[model samples]
Each structure stands twice: as structure tokens, then as C-alpha cells.
Target chain A: MTRAFNFSAGPATLPESVLRQAQAEMLEWNGAGASIVEMSHRGPEFMAVAAQAEADLRTLMSIPDDYAVMFLAGGATTQQALLALNFAAPGQTCDYVVNGHWGKTAIKQVGHYVNPHVAASSEAGGFHDIPARSSWQLSPDAAFVHITANETIHGVEFRDTPDVGNVPLFADFSSSIASEPIDVSRYGLIYAGAQKNLGPVGVSVVIVRRDLLERAGQPRADIFNYRSHVARDSMLNTPPTWNWYLAGLMFQWMLAQGGVQEFARRNATKAALVYDAIDTSSGFYRNEVVPAVRSRMNIPFFLPDDTLTARFVSESKAAGLLALKGHKAVGGIRASLYNAMPVEGAQALVAFMRDFQQRNG
Target chain B: MTRAFNFSAGPATLPESVLRQAQAEMLEWNGAGASIVEMSHRGPEFMAVAAQAEADLRTLMSIPDDYAVMFLAGGATTQQALLALNFAAPGQTCDYVVNGHWGKTAIKQVGHYVNPHVAASSEAGGFHDIPARSSWQLSPDAAFVHITANETIHGVEFRDTPDVGNVPLFADFSSSIASEPIDVSRYGLIYAGAQKNLGPVGVSVVIVRRDLLERAGQPRADIFNYRSHVARDSMLNTPPTWNWYLAGLMFQWMLAQGGVQEFARRNATKAALVYDAIDTSSGFYRNEVVPAVRSRMNIPFFLPDDTLTARFVSESKAAGLLALKGHKAVGGIRASLYNAMPVEGAQALVAFMRDFQQRNG
Candidate 1:
């Protein structure tokens, strides 16, 4: 079967090998006598799988011993609230660098827990470019400086982690995590919803510096507290077991493909293919992102004729490319080249783009 | 191939038909040429799935139109906190009926959000039976009266929903939902973790009365807000999609098997086989739960000698009955007969138990 390339922003594509392995072991896992989904989280069978997944993820990112890694429910959206509720004491200020849709949402959600100060925002520029690091107005009294490392909707990405002196830097690495190598020590905490580059839906990974644990807010609710989950090894309650197993499989697959460094190299090559086609389209197509900060994971392009948009999406889908429709907030076309999207998928998209441009232009 | 009977408390057994259907469509669904996991939640394909699931569940429970059904993240433990945060204002009194382990946990967790009132408790009896309805203490000003419909650990079940006049009743039905028909209108809200009868882990079902939505507390965070989830059709953010898909399949399977009425009949028969074995054993095995209040879903029985517990679990495993080791809080054997457990599985356990008692008694 010639499988369609899925370009969904989330609940997105996963490595084909991982899918095949999951299919083969749907009912039984590694002769454990039962499926991973059917095993209790506290049992040795599922515990070993969870431990391996955590270990592999730690290895892939070279996570420091000072960090506590937690697999939690709710994606980046919930983390938006949890991060603030966990870190900020009542009336404490938190800095947020708002660039795109998710970052803006983060600012609003976090406000329910603390006073969120937008240290910098790209709204004035239509989110085409990130605010320069030098221009960021982080406060010395802030508990943490929040940043969306990659914006899936507007296709903007941060090239480097911002340095906030004496303040812990928190980042939502949802879309860009594992796309490249990262330094664990640079950020106080990092969280990613595991739908795009990771594995599947239902689990989000939170890695926080151990020191930050001592500074968590006077928790209003036990379930919202990160400290409790850390104390119990993220099993303070029954976790999403099957998602954890699949994520472990993903970590193993990522390691087999030479870790995130190799992913970085391949991602760059894939991103360039789509960008080159759009750049050379001679006004036939346009990508609104500032070239310097364009996301390698998501690329949004616009056709010169608005009427051509529907035809492009329908035809591209018919040609075995799927989920190319842009987010409703940002309309045009979006090709999400997540970690699992093969280089061939990008090349296929470029070819389709060129064919459409030639006939339409 | 014959599959082993899984007796784990949760992330537990699933109907064979559900597993087979999931495996067959692992790569594609509805001839869409894409896996259901690959479908976008907002797209018509997955929407149809989400819609059908909601409809089937509403039909199964006879949920009134006034109730809003939501598929959420976090487990029942989280729901304990959410129920308080969403329904109770600061310092508002909420009554929790603590009959067993889960109820006790709910009382403690809900305290994080509101002043919890223990209307009735069975701790004096060591969680052996439900407190009679006449013994419950009522609070006219309570936010909601909470109950654990079925206690998974203690093996005690409420034969009927408690009447908390004027005060909306809330239930954590994680272990007992879909095992039999329910009167949805009696409760203001019901939430269940999907690991038991529903399917795998990661998603939770929340059925809230629409009128109750108007009384929500000051918003703590958008993602945790029940009102936000209901307004957006529970797509407040990317939900646990794969779990949702499997749950939809389970609901379809339940409907095919004559709905909850059939499940109730089968479960009662299964419970009878295990209970009868212990009752007729002449003190070799004992179930401390009072006969009338014992749960048909979780039946915990103790051996005459505690030293034989491990051997019993090992022997049960070898005999194809898995995860029968009781909760550490309650030392014994616990067989969880969810909707998926075949009647023959219960018979097999009975036959094995009679033999073991004869040899060891």
C-alpha cells in the first residue's frame, strides 16, 4: 500500500515502523502474556515499559540529573495552566513571550493562576517574526519566563533559548521537541504534548529542574500539583498506560535513527525542500514567516489566488497527501513536517506545489 | 487463539470484539485510507466517531438531554478534584459519602478545592459494607453530594444511588459504568476513567447536567473548566484521541450485546459463581464483604492462610486467570468482572478455586 503522508498539526504522523510493531503486538506484548494496554501500571510488565520510555527519553535529550521527568495528562493546553499554577505563588508575576496562536492562548490560560506579563509579543507584526531576544522585557521578580519554542499555526520557531538572568525559563516545546538536540540545563522546565514529533495523543512530557520543585505554588488542588506527581513518579494516579508504551517505542525508534541530531539534519533537509519550492514560486505562493525564524516542523504557504486554496487542498489530498488544510485561524495551506514525516513526503509536497503553480499561475 | 482472562483492576480487560476490530483497522478505517488515529478531531471523519460515541453512551445510560457528555483527560482521581473546583465556590461545603478506598481518597482530594463534608462513612466497619441510607447525614447547603458508585479496592458496591434531596449528586463510576443500566437523571454529574469496561487508559467520560454548568466556580484555568469543554464539544484541546476511538468501539460492542441489561445478567451470573465457591468452602476461603452489598464487579476473597496468597496468584496466572492479586490495601484475591469478562472465565475460576481448597484446606 502506498500510504498517504499525514501533515496534521497534531494527533499527527508517527513512524511507520512503530505503527507496524504496535499492530503486531496489539494483543500481546513481548510474550508478557497480555497486551501492554491490558497490564496494570503498578505491575512489573508495564512499569518496566514506563521506566524504559523515561530512560530512553532522558538519554535522547541528555536530561540532567537535576531534572524530574513526568508523563502527564492534558497536552500543552493544560500545561499552560498547570505550569503557572505549579510555579507561581499567589500574586507572583510570570513572564510570557507571546509569538503565535498557542503562545497567546498560554498567556490567557496562565492568567487564571497568576499575573501573566507579556514580556514580548509578535501580535503587532502578524506573528511573522519572533520578538528579538534583546527586546524581551523579563522582570527580575518573575517566577518563570514562559516561551513557546515552536508555533504550529503561524510557522514561527525560536532558534535559541532565551537567557533570563536569575529567573527560571519555562518552555512549551510541544511542536519542536526532539526535532533537534537540546541543552537540558538552559531551561528550568520543558514540556511537550506527545502528538506531533513524539508518538500519539493522551500523554504530555514535563521535565523540570529538581530545584524548581521547592518553589511550587501553595497548590489549590492536588491533581494540579506537579510536586505530587514527581513524588509518586507520575503514578499519583493511574496514567495513560498505552500512550506511555507507544511513547517508549517512539523513544526507541528515535534512538535507533541516531537520536535528535540525525532528526535535525533530516528535518533541515525536508524543510528546505518545501521552503525552496515556495520561495521560487515567483509570486505564485507566499510563506508569511520571516525566513530567519520559519519553523522546520510546520510550514504555512498562501496561494496568490484565494479561490485556488480549496482546489489545492482537495487535489493534494487526492494525491495521497493529507491534513494540508491550514488552521482556521490562519488560512491557506500548512504542511506539517513532523519527525515521522519522511524526506520523501516533503519532496512529494514540493512536486505537487510546483505542478499546481504551473497550471494556476 | 484463546485469550487469558485479565483481572487487573483497570487498564484491564476489553471485549474480544473491540480488540479484533481495532486490530483489523489499525491502518485504515471506513475506507478513508487512513487510520482513525490519523483523522483530525475537527474533521468530519473523527467528528462522526465522537458523535456516535456520545450518542451510544447516552442511549446506554438513558442520559437525559439536560446532561452534557464530555470526554476528558486525567482519571477519576482527577475528577474528584475537578468536581470540587468546578462546582464548589471557595469555602463552600461539599458532602462526600466515604464507604471505601476511592471514597476516602475523594474526600481527601476534594478538600484541596473546597470544604468537604463527610455525610456518611463506613471506616468504622473497615470498609466491609455500605453505610445504610438511613444513617447518612445530610447538609442542605452542600454544593454536591459525592459517592463512589463502586469501590474497586474494598469490593463493596452501592446497590442503588443515594438520594440527596435538592443537592445535586455526583458519582465516580469508573469501575461500574456500563456494567448495567443507570438512571442518569438521578445524578448531577458522572465521570469514569476509561481503563475498565470502556477500553484503555488516557481518556475519561464526564456527563454533567447542563443546569449545573451555570453554578461553576470562579475559573481556575480554561482547560480544567467543565464549561469550556462542554461549549467546545470537549475539543477544548487535543483530547486523548486513540482512547476515544477504542471507547467508541467498546460502546458499539456493548450496544450489539443487548446493552447494559445483558452485561448486568452476565456479571451477576459470574459474580455468583465466585461468591458461591467461597460461601460453600467451609471456611477455607472468605469474602468479608456483606452478602447484599458485595460488588458484582470486584469480588475479593481471602485464603485461610495469608502465606498462600502469592502461590494462589501464581497458580491463577498459570491457569490463565491474571491479575487476581488483591489490592495491597486489602490482602486477598480480587477478580474484576467487567463487561468484557466471559461467563466461562468465571466458571474456570470457580473450578480452580474448588480444587485449590480441596488440596490446601
Candidate 2:
């Protein structure tokens, strides 16, 4: 059966081809007679899968050789606490730039482990844009500078990597990791939850500079220790094997799509098609995020009147445009066009939006 | 394709029927036209799946309504830390009974959050037997008592639940959660990683008494807070959706197989078949664990002459008996007969053992 376009913020859509391959191999992987999920992590079969995933991801992102890729659990939210626990000692502070919901969540989670200094925040402007880097207050002895590259809830994204001078720059790129090209050398660490662009919801990928790995501070439990994960090659414990396997398939699928450059061009086209409908609708539909900082992945928009919101969602569902309901915190419609969303799906959504606007306006 | 009879300790074999069903619904679940993996956790579709899973597990285990069944991440190892961080404050102590590798790992992890008291241990006995309850050194102010019901590595199991009087009891039921009937009312918490009797490796089942929910000390990070998980129904963060979904299927499969009573009978027959071979081998094969506390899930044993150990593994693999290699810590063979392992699989192992004994004895 053909799959529907799922615009869920997470546990999101995956490429049908990847799912097909995974399903075909769900019982016997590579004629090994055992599913990849059933294989031991330390075994050569799974080690090859893990290594290949890292290699492909590195190539796609142009990851520096100085960085170590770690597949971890606990999502990016756990990374929020981990970042502080690893870098910021009790007495030390870290710089956190708050742009939207994810950034704010990072700040709150980090505060539990260390004193987090809010360097710059776009909350004053309702998190519709990234705070200017020039407005950030840098701490000379700060452990690191943190940011969320894309806010799925607010449909805001950072078009450029922040220049944090000497302090290591860390990003929670959960919603934006593979969406476009990135300069791996610009950051000390970059992590993303796999639900959106990667594969499943269990694994989180963390890329850390080799030098910064040693600064992961005092030893913690095996699960929480970044150094332990890196040292053991992310097999310190039984990993989410099936999730990792699915992610490996996703990496292969991404590669088959002509890698990152091709993905960026396709994503841009999909985003523009939807944005064009919202823009041309005049007073009928309006996007909340600033045009310059608008996300190419998630497009959150509003109807001219609040009364049409429920109708829009209900109608969209009937039209098979699912999960277009905006985040509760941001009341509007949100269309998340992640990597798996085909151009036709986006076109269908754009056409539906145009028709709805014409009939309502 | 038929999957192999995988004997991995954890991240072990899944029920072939469950894998078939999952593969059938990979792209479209029910009539949703979206995979369960891709569905939004909060959406009615997945909420129904999650709720049904919890309901099925509760029924299968006869879990009380007052208990909160949580689908969590990071496996049983994470639960050790969570149990410590939630139940015991920094200066307080919790009692831990150590029998084998899992128990020792739990003790070490609990040390990260609380000073765990070694109330009883079988390490002095080479971890081949469960310590008698009478020999335990209990602490009056202990927050709780933790035990591993079945030690997957050493093939030691607590045949009976320990009585902790008024203090709550917690069991890491990772290897034997659904293998037999459990007295849910006797314990405050029962946690299991899905790899063994459950489903996969990424998701863990944490059933906690409702009253113990607030014992989660303080608000930690979202991932570590048991209260946050209970409050959000394990959707506090995007859960390991696919793993949880597969676990739900496993729970349903358990119910279909006549629940724990039927499982207990099947598991007993399987274990007895293997153990009977070892017992009658006459100095050829030796299982060290006392019969009273021998595990029905994992059967760890050794050849009288250790020189044949490599040959055993090599010859077993040639017969398609894979992953029979014991853990490094225990230099012998271990066959983990989790709930998914067919009785035929165990019989095959026993047959192989008997044939080998006849040839070498």
C-alpha cells in the first residue's frame, strides 16, 4: 500500500523505499539468517552497519575527522542536560541562545545541571526569528555556546551557523540536521534526534570534536557518559539495534538521492511551493515566522481568522493532508516537509491550500 | 524468509509472527495509511496502540490498576539509574541483591545516584546460585530492595520473590518478564528491557506503583524523570515509537499464547530439556547453578574439559546454532531461551549437546 504523507513533528515520515528495504530484511538481514535487530552489537555484521552509518553521515555533513560520531539514546532533550553535564562544571556557566521552543527547552534542561547564561533570546519577538549573533553576550570562560538550528514548533531556522569566536559551538539540530549543507568545523558538537530526518525515535546522533570528548567531565553512568559512548564506539550497552539498522538504511537512501546537495535543492523546491501558496493567498493565509528565518522543513501558518483553524485541520484531514495542526503553543497550521515528503505530497498540499484560500477568501 | 533461532543474550530473537505482522504493516497500519512508527504519539491512532499495549500487558501480568506502566528508553541499565535517582536521594541507601553480571551492573549504576547496600550477594559462590533470603543483610531505612529475577549470563534466577516487609521491592525482569506468572502486588516496581521476553532493545517497560511516582525526588531532566514519563504516558518525549509498537505486538502475542501460565509451561519444558541433557551427561556437560535457583530463561553451562569450548562454539555454528558463545566474563556456553524462542530451538540445542556428549564422553 502507498503510504500517506505524515507531517508529524516526530515519529515522522520515512522514505517508502527505506521502509520497503527494512521490511524485506526484517527477518533475515543480508542473508545472515538473523535480523539486524537480533545481531549482537559487538558482532562484525552490526559493527559494519554502525561504521557505515557514521561514514555516510560524515560524508554527507562533511564532518571533520577530528570529530567522533556517537549514536545515543534519550533524544536531543537528554543531550540538553548532557551538554551541561559534560562541559559545564557546577561552578561554571554556559551560553544558551534561545530562539524557540526547542532552545527554551534546552535552556531549562541545562539549568538543571549547570548555571546557563541566556546570551540572546528571540522570545521578546515571539521566537519568530533568530536573535542576531551580534546581540549575544559571550562569557569568556563559558564552557560552550548552545543553539537549536531549527525550531519545529515555531517554523524558524538559522540560515547560517553562529560565529562563537573561541568557545565551542554546540547545536541541537534535531529538526534540521540533514536538511542542507553544514560546515562541520564551525561547531564543537552537533546532535540530532533520529525521528525527523534520520529514521526512528529511539536513537540520537552526537558528533563531538575529539578534544572536547575528554572534557566530558567526571565519570557518569554508562548511558549518560559521552566519553564512554565514544570510547566503546556507541556500543557501551545494547543499542537500539533495530533503530540503528533503520537509520543505516536511511543513510543509504539519502545517499541514493544524490546525497545532501540534491536533498537541499529538492527541499528548497518543496518549501517554496508551499510558501508560494501561503504568500499569494494575500489576507487568507499568513505564516508567522520571519521570511528570512522561515524553516524549509516546517511551515507554520495561520488563517486570517481563528474560527477557520479547526475547519482547516478537519478539512485537511479529509483531504489526506495529515498532522497539519500547529503546535498547541503556536496555534495555526503546520506542514512539516521533512526528507521523506515527496515533491508531489508538497504539491498536493500547496494545491489544496490554494483551493481552500480561494473558496474561503 | 524465516528468521534464525537467534540466541543473543539481549536484543535477542523476536517472535516471527510479530515480525511478520509488523512487516505487513510497515507502511500502512490498520487503515491509517501510515506506519505505526510514523504516527504522532499524541494522535488518536497511536494513542490507541499505546493504550492497548499497556492494557494488554496489565492483563497478561495481572498488574494492578494503581500501577503506572511506562514505555521508556535506554533499556534496563537506564532503569537502574532511574530507580536510584527516583527512589533514593543522594545520602540515602537502597538494598541490592547481586547474583550475576546484570545484578552487578545494576549495583554499579545505582552507585551513581545512591549508596546501594549490598544486602545479599552470590559473587562469593561464583554467581552460580541465588543468595538465600535468610542470609540477606537488610537496612531498616533502605528506600527499596532491588533484585534481578533472572541472571541471563550466569543462569541464576530467584525462584521466589523476596519478602521486604514494608519496604518496596523492585526487580529487573529484563530476561524473564513475561516468561512466567509474576506476583505484581508484591513489588513496587517491575522493569524490563524489550530485547528478551519483550520485543526489541530500545524500549523498556517500567511498571511502578502510582504512590511511588512522586518518589522521583526532584524534577530532573525530562528523560530521567519517571514522574514526567508517567504524567505524559511515556510520550514525554518522542518515545522509541517502533520499539514500543513492537513491544505492544509482543504483549498481544503473549495474551494470544494464553498469557504467562502457558509461557511458564513452555519455558519450563524447554529449560528442563536442556538441563536434563546436562544433568545426565555424566561428567561431560556441567551446569553450575543449583537446581532450585536455575534460570528457566538462560541455561549457562560448561564442558568438563575447557579445551573443547572453542570446538563447541565452532561446531554448534556449523549446525546453525549461533550466538551460543557465552559471555566473556563466564567462559562457557549460554543458551538464552527467551519467550520468543520456540521449544524446538531448545530441543535442538539439547539434541546437539547429547550428540556431542555421546561422541566425546
Estimate candidate 2's alpha-carbon lDDT, on a 0 to 1 scale.
Answer: 0.85
* Poorly placed runs, candidate 2 (over 4 Å): A216-219, B216-219, B305-307
- DockQ top scorer: 1
Mark the regions of model 1 whose C-alpha exceeds 4 Å error after superposition: none
iRMS of each prediction in angstroms?
A: 1.6, 1.9
CA-lDDT, candidates in order: 0.88, 0.85
Q: Which candidate tops TM-score? A: 1
Q: Give the distance in Å from residue A341's predicted Cα in candidate 1 to where it truly belongs.
A: 0.3
- The residue-by-residue lDDT of candidate 2 on B1-361, one tens digit each, is 6456677787788888888898889888997868888888888888988899989998999999999999987878888878877888775889988998888889877565677899999999899788888999988898999999889888999888889898899999999997898789899999988888886779889999999887746435666788888889998888887888888898999899888999999999999999999899886888999899999998888997677888888788778777888888887888999888889999888888988877777
Candidate 2 structure quality by residue, lDDT tens digits, A1-361: 6566778888789888888888898778897778887877877788899889889988888898999998887788888878877776764788989999888888777555677899999999999888888889989899999988889999999999988999999998998888888888899999999999886779999999999977846335666778878889988888888888888889889988988788899889999999899888876888878899999999999997777888888888888888888889988899988888889989999888888877877
